[model samples]
Target: MYDVSNPHYMGDHTGTRKFRRVLLKLSGEALREPGSTDNISPPIVEDIAAQIKAAHQTGLEIAVVVGGGNFWRGVSASNKGMERATADYMGMLATVMNSLALQSMLEAMDVPTRVQSAIEMKNVAEPFIRRVATRHLELGRVVIFAAGTGNPFFSTDTTAALRASEVGADCVFKATKVDGIYCSDPNKNPDAVRFDTISFHDCLTKQLKVMDATAFSLCMENNMPIIVFSMNEPDNIRRALVGESMGTLVNASGKDA
Candidate 1:
């Protein structure tokens, strides 16, 4: 069990409590360190599990959407002449693998978890059912959604947005390598400006690449807010959940007419 004595307990009022329930979106690359092959590193998985456990202990309902970029990317495979649909299906399977690995880590920490796939894989996980997922959340099970909307050409970002809306999540936390959204690629341009808050419309007009067009459109249409933050920082996940002002907040409130 994690030492609750640490100051990072989830519900602490020192941090803002922006939302009641949240959907966390993680990329497949997050499972492994950069330049490593596709697979979940034990340390990384455990670290993420610990963070989720902390948030779970705070009595917040959490759900996750994981991507499959490490194992497969339909766009890249299609470039190699593989059929788009076939490549996408392969990507979906990769996400299932990631989901199972995450589930194992979360369960090891004694956090109850359920894996729900957009495509049916009864032997491995439950099919994507909105009510079932909601019930799982109500029961305090951390639900991990996999398979990227069960369709071709749609990115996992879209899946996260859709799942967040369906589960009635107050916001979607997009865990990324960077601390927040910037005016330019932070790595490429050291002087790039980071936005504490940005409107979805401005992000779209600026082509900020916070998320793909489809996902951004879905969130904008639904008025769902998304918080982009760094996953590398140990307590960042808990911080974001508790509404600490740590990353970029993108929503309708920040949107410009």
Candidate 2:
């Protein structure tokens, strides 16, 4: 068993070889086509799966944590009068749906896949077990972590960091709408500067919102690196897997290699 808690466990972060294992964090919006009423788009999922398939072909162990913002946002629903816990639970169900869709597409592409849900639904997905998930990855099976840590008030971003730390992943790859982290919201600030690399301490001190506070804290505490990059870029997933340096990397040191 890979002991992530061991003090001397220096993950495969040498950048001397291809990443041994990584956790990809994808938002639910990635599955929905913009300007379309549909909540889930097959073509978008297929595109994402194709890139992942190409990367998996390289023998890199891949695990994914998918968010549920497309179908539901717990905080948004709660603010509209629904109970917070109930709204969060509904959000968890949404992630399960997205996970199943991605799994179907990856399997259709002949890539072995598994969906592990934190909130178990026996007929559809296996209950999340750390050892089992690690074993699946070791066997070269792609594992999609769904249901957001089986608890309310925890964002999927936090789940990504937590899972990466638990599984001894080399880094957390955040597939987002933006190309990388910027000094400000690039859309709003035309002059916002993008950093090739930034330190976790700087990210906090500067209030760069690469992720939620809890997620950032978790990654920092675990010394897990995060790569923030755009999912819309063609073959970006594969590029990231092979360490082609396309996005902003957040780590202990603020320097890019």
Candidate 3:
């Protein structure tokens, strides 16, 4: 169990009210280091669990949605003649694997975690239920949503947005390798400028690739702010939760004002 009595609580002084609840979206690749064949690296899992534990200790309710790209991508495979439904099912299974690994890591750190899947896999996780998930959060257990909405065509990003809306999360945090949204591909364009904040309309107009069109639209329509930031940096997850102003904040308004 995470010791809630620890004195290392980092405070946020940005005057922005802290989010009461948040949805964190993790990509499958984040469970491993770059260019590695391993599906679940022990160090990466430990690091993530530690960050999540810290944030949870601060009294913010959290829910997670993980992608299955590290093991497979149903849509990508379907383009090569694989049956779309079958490929999607495989992708859902992959997400379950990632969710289990994450749950184990968080539990090892005493963070109290639960895994819920869209498709019923009674042997592994509970079938996703909105009320049950809300109860878990209220009771201080981290809820990890898996299986991608139990649908074939939708991506996990869409699932994250949908779940955030369903659970009334105040914001969605997208953990990426990059620190923030840039004007262009930061890797190729060294001079790409990073935005401290951005509007949903501007992101769509500029064709920003922070998230898919479907996910972005859902969040926009519902007035949910999404933050994109680097998970590779130590303590970034906790910092973001505390309103550190380290990521690109996407909201409905044209500006933060």
Candidate 4:
């Protein structure tokens, strides 16, 4: 349905985006390089920004919810030797840093971007205001949401689902290290089976870890569809926005399955 070769192409054969509005879930760990401890890899982040710019140029309203695992994984920190709440707050700050980095790169690509934090850092980003964020999206500006629901225990996956519902997004695109949800860890099991599509009930029955339980439940309750795809492929973000079948789709109805 999409012209995969042209970055500026917005619509499909039907002359319109299959999904005009989508929420992109980005993990901070995805920004780091192999064997590198850097919180934000310049080349990686810039490439992601370029992809986002390409999709943005097509008139799609894009919103990103970034995680903080590259800087600090809250759960890991708590396991190592820190208090749970304190570690999670630190992780929230890490997300802020990643958001700023992404904003800078996106702006350099001439894509107007805004970083909104739930924790309300007036200096670095605007406070998370639902109306203002939606307006930014309506104006074709990329909005980066950070701080993971402004709470300690929640995750960025929940943020993506929450923001997608809040902004009336058609679907949530989960940019992941793997190509799609599998019966088992693809990295570990060579025989793992990848799912092109799966119902929410099936996902829960299998206990697939595409998203945390809370996040998945929220999307299921709201009847939101989620596409989990690999970010390793260049321009995959733009491709997904244009409705290419590049990942496994999760929904309440298993029609796509």
Indicate which candidate wins on TM-score.
2
Compose the digit string of candidate 3's lDDT tens values, residues 12-114. 4453436778899999999977888898788988888888889899988899999999999999999999999999999999999999999999999889999
What are the per-model C-alpha RMSD values against the true structure?
5.7, 3.8, 5.5, 4.4
Stretches off by above 4 angstroms in model 3 are 1-17
Candidate 3, after superposition: displacement of residue 169 in Å? 0.4
Candidate 1: residue pairs that collide: none
Tens digit of lDDT per residue, candidate 2, span 146-224? 9999999999999999999998898899999899999999999999999988888898899988799889889989888
Sequence-dependent TM-score of model 4: 0.92
TM accuracy, model 3:
0.92
The number of residue pairs in model 1 that clash at the backbone is 0
What is the per-residue lDDT of model 4 for residues 125-242, given as tens digits with 9 covering 90 to 100?
Answer: 9999999999999999999998989998888999998998898887889999899999999889999999877877888888999899888888888888888999888788778776
List runs of model 1 lying over 4 Å from the truth: 1-15, 255-257
Model 1, span 1-257: residue lDDT tens: 11111122233444354456789999999889767764678888888888888988888899999999878899999999999999999999999999999999999989999999999989999999999999999999999999989999999999999999899888889999999899999999999999977877888988998799889889988888788999888889887776676788787657312
lDDT for predicted candidate 4 compared with the true structure: 0.86
Error of 4 at 59 (Å): 0.6
Q: Model 1 misses residue 32 by how many Å? A: 0.5
Error of 3 at 68 (Å): 0.8
lDDT of each model, Cα atoms only? 0.85, 0.88, 0.86, 0.86
> Candidate 2 has what TM-score?
0.93
Worst lDDT 10-window in candidate 4: 1-10
lDDT of 3 at 239: 86
